[model samples]
Target: MKVCFVGSSGGHLMHLYMLKRFWADKERFWVTFDKEDARSLLGEEKMYSCYFPSNRNIKNLIKNTFVAAKVLKNEKPDVIISSGAAVAVPFFYIGKLLGAKLIYIEVFDRIDKSTLTGKLVYPITDKFIVQWEEQKTVYPKAINLGSIF
Candidate 1:
């Protein structure tokens, strides 16, 4: 299956990277920030950069929505996954419309509450995962996958 892994530059990106076992053998690419760390870690991977400072940033959100349309159209990944900040919103929405399965892994840290991105995408996500069992209270339908670390 083809996968599109999308997230922000730091821990969110790291969370997705931890799924290498699942993605390594698949046809996959990434959508993340074009920061130094992402550049270094995904040096040899197919990647697309997205607009950042995405939290509450209308302009970047609009820009990333366009980026999402273009990339998801081009890649046509069968699945899209993220442990996100805010960047994943646009991609998940468009990917769902494009008939790609969406998986949103709630960050390992947020134990009982939801992140903004998680809350925004939960209704549309095909699989919503949480690292802590306690988080199930907030995302009742979420599967408890434990830490991807």
Candidate 2:
């Protein structure tokens, strides 16, 4: 199965990167911004770029959306697993429209509630996971996958 890991920098990428071992034998790829931390975490052979800026700017958002749409068209992954900040929004939407499963893993920091993306994509997501049990009250459908750490 082809899998695409989509997320932003720091904690989001770190959590998603941990899943790499499970897909070591399958087709796998990742999408992240041009941040140094994100670039360092990406493997030389299995990564793609999306021009998402850390700050919220209209230009960057539009550029990232276009880049995301193109990547989804080209990769045509079977599923997309995401630990979102913001970039996951476009990736998930496009992947979903293309008939791909969208799996969302809420950020580890979200102890009491779901992240914005988690809430936005909840109904459409094939699977929703939460690391914190406390988040269950907020996202009743979220599966408790424990911590990805």
Q: Mind giving the per-residue lDDT tens digits that candidate 1 earns over 53-93?
A: 99989999999999999999999999999999899999999
Q: Give Cα distance to truth, residue 41, candidate 2, Å.
A: 1.9
After superposition, candidate 1 runs with Cα above 4 Å error = none
lDDT of 2 by residue, 49-122 (tens): 77666345668667777977899899989999998877888888888999999899988887986677787788
TM-score of each: 0.98, 0.91
Off by over 4 Å in 2: 54-56
Candidate 2's TM-score reads 0.91
Clashing pairs in 2: none
TM-score of the candidate numbered 1? 0.98
